[model samples]
Target: MVTIKDIAKELNLSYSTVSLALNASPMVSKTTMRRVKEAAREMGYKPNAMARALVLKRSGIIGIIVPDITNPFFSSVAFGAEQAAHKRGYNLLICNTEWNDELESHHLTLIVEKKIDGLLIASVNKKNHLLEGIIKQDLPLVFISSAYPSARCNFVGIDAEPGGYLVGKHLTDLGHREIAFVGGKFNSFSVQRRYAGFIKALADQKIAFNKEYTLSGEFSIESGYENGIKLLKKFPKVTATMAADDLIAVGMLKAMLERGIRVPQDFSIVGFDDIFIASLPGIELTTVFQEKKLMGELAMNILLDELNSGGDSKREKKSIVLSPRLVIRNTTAPPHSE
Candidate 1:
């Protein structure tokens, strides 16, 4: 492990000059900085991430907490965040909370102990008061997906309600009257917004919104399958189904297919978050296209901005809500012939 000191010694430069040049401080001339960088590269010198962090109060690491990495949506988010971090010469440490409050709390505590520069959370547990303490301490905290309703912080996500409304409106326009909804936990902020928007859209169209048609499950294909069974049996007259996410939609698709229900002929379906699997030839799920990658990039960039700007008390926080587009595909159609 070659150190900056070795490069300085080899170049016969002062240690302070070398350090300033390596940091790219404006105090050091650009020519000197270039020469120092080149020399460091030639020497294969690696900056001591922890050692330098102690002096500068920057760990060169951003911490990201997510519920599940196995989900394609979250994978895209991680990819975009990783790309942005690399561009800015930083690294990210990702922790999967698996929807456990204790796990999320543990990761938060560890990140704080590490003196990590910033945090990005695709939070599952909204009641985590530790997060409030983190925010109060002025750490750069950015919510990557849905955030708490009242917390004043940087947030990056699609407009959840509007995205749901898009699906509802599309179904309604296609002459779908008796529609059913499948979604994640009702307590989730994202779930609530989506359900609310879906209901509002149906109400605007004067379609009867049946409370019995709304069902909650975990955000997984298995959960979707289970709910599909209940939905079809109890609401046989349903003309279409609106899923809160692509995964749920995909699950429901499987259930319907197994039951010999012809898609778009017997029933139509719509989903949110046009994840990769939604575009598979057999699936082709009509869904709202959220800029998943862009969301991650924006969240990381926002955190970086917060970290670099000193995150002063007076700096106003901002939330970035991207637009969602409806991707019409094979999964949806007008009601079938009676």
Candidate 2:
């Protein structure tokens, strides 16, 4: 509760002199600055962030919006952003949208109202008009794990097509022709790119893709579990499957195991984003590693660069696409003859 006025009264110094000394302004004598700092420490004076932000024209706060915090992949991305922002004396305000577009838009509006220094959003949809509007306003914004090519804004995401292609090639290499894809919403750019790459790999192997075998839902364990059961029961001949993400893969794996299916013996599963759960002793899910945390770190770095540019008219737009690597684990293997 201690203010500069209290310090000025206690030290019998002019309010202007005390303010200059507290801020280490060169206009104040070094001795005066030292004394003012000492008094501040003794009086338990804490600087007001809002007051400081008003003077600097920046909040020193960054806002990050994710589809779902319960998903480990998104959580890792947030953690990376937080760490990077903290190192530079900035704090992060995390907002979870639960994969709803309405919530995402609402959160974006709230963040803008707060006058955040910058923003990092893992968009709920592929093409967002709201995001485009924000970009047009020249806000320092970065997309994490997703991007819209037409927007020409800052984005940090993984090479999803290549990651999907890797999974498709791996499955085909293991002699899995009767395959299926259980993924998130088909409208999602990440899902579309991954499916495109996967289909290309299948075409390379001269295998025709069956639209009936493709399933789409939210990128959640529940959706994965439900679709997985449906796929296994309906197709019966499928020997392997590729999941859009680790959560989906784990869900499908659980569903299969619960039905007394032997993984890698009766069926093979591959997932994306090698989340922590995928590496557990019993799971060991084969997946494509997408550098989840690094994606977040890179997105925050891009935002930081834009924020520090100080409203330069020639500010450069940046996009970072990280490569994906396949991690062979216990979940994938050559198909066995029935």
Candidate 3:
């Protein structure tokens, strides 16, 4: 609880002189600055962040709002963001929405009320009006994963359609005709883009799209497990399945294994986002790799640039769309060759 007043008393200097010395003001002599710093360090004196923020109008804190922290994809993104924030001498406040719009709004309000320097949001829905309000306020906000094309805000996301197309093309090249798509809720742009790409690829190859083979639900392992069971029972002739994410693929894989269906022999699976567990000995998931860490780092850098620039110029909002790569593994093969 030591304050600048305590440091001034210990050094026999006035409070104004101590404040100028601690702040490295040009008026303070070098010798006085050194003595003040030494005394403050010795006494464990720390400036109040609230007072500093009030004076500067910036908390030096960035807020990140994501849909689900339990998902490994978001966790990786958070790690990269934290690393970049720390490197630039800033702190991060992460809020998990659990795909709830109300909670997301609450977190956004709190972050704005706290006067954070910037915001990094991965919204639950693409067309959220709440995000529009934030943009209208001229907040330094960056959208990740889900974004509206009409919004005049900075966004960093991947070309999900092309990535999904790649998955479908890979499967088709491997002679998978009866392909199924396991995706998250239909409202997500990521899911929709991936599905569109998959459908496009299939149509190009003269493979007819079947409604019975498609399934959608929450992007969770349990949802994947339940959907996998339903898809397998309903479409026993399905040869290949492209999952929207690694978690869904893993869940489906577990269900297939439990049902005594050998992967790549009975069914081929392709997943998106090459998570850490995707390459495990048992899983060996053949999937699309989205460079999530790089995305997070770039988002932070963009926010910092905007904050430092003081919103003076109308910088062209950047829409970075990273390309996804296909990681070949043991999970995918020519359908029913075994």
- Top candidate by TM-score: 1
Cα-based lDDT at residue 156, candidate 3: 86
lDDT string for model 1 (1-338, tens) is 88777888988999888887876555678899899999988888877767888777788899888888888888889889989987666898999988778888899899889888888887657777888788788888889778867678788897789888888899999999999989887878887888888888999999889888989988899999998888889999998999988899999999999999989888898988899999999999999898999888999888876666565656778798888799999999899977
RMSD of each: 3.4, 6.0, 5.8
Q: What is the per-residue lDDT of model 2 for residues 188-306, given as tens digits with 9 covering 90 to 100?
A: 78888999899999999999989888999878889889988998889999999999999999999999999988998999999999999999999999999988888888898778767
The regions of model 2 sitting more than 4 angstroms off are 1-48
Tens digits of per-residue lDDT, candidate 3, 72-104, equal 899888888889887655789999999988888
TM-score against truth, every candidate: 0.87, 0.85, 0.84
Q: Rank the candidates by lDDT, best first.
A: 2, 1, 3
Off by over 4 Å in 1: 1-47
| Candidates 2 and 3 compared by TM-score, better number | 2
lDDT of 1: 0.85
Q: Which residue pairs in candidate 3 collide?
A: none
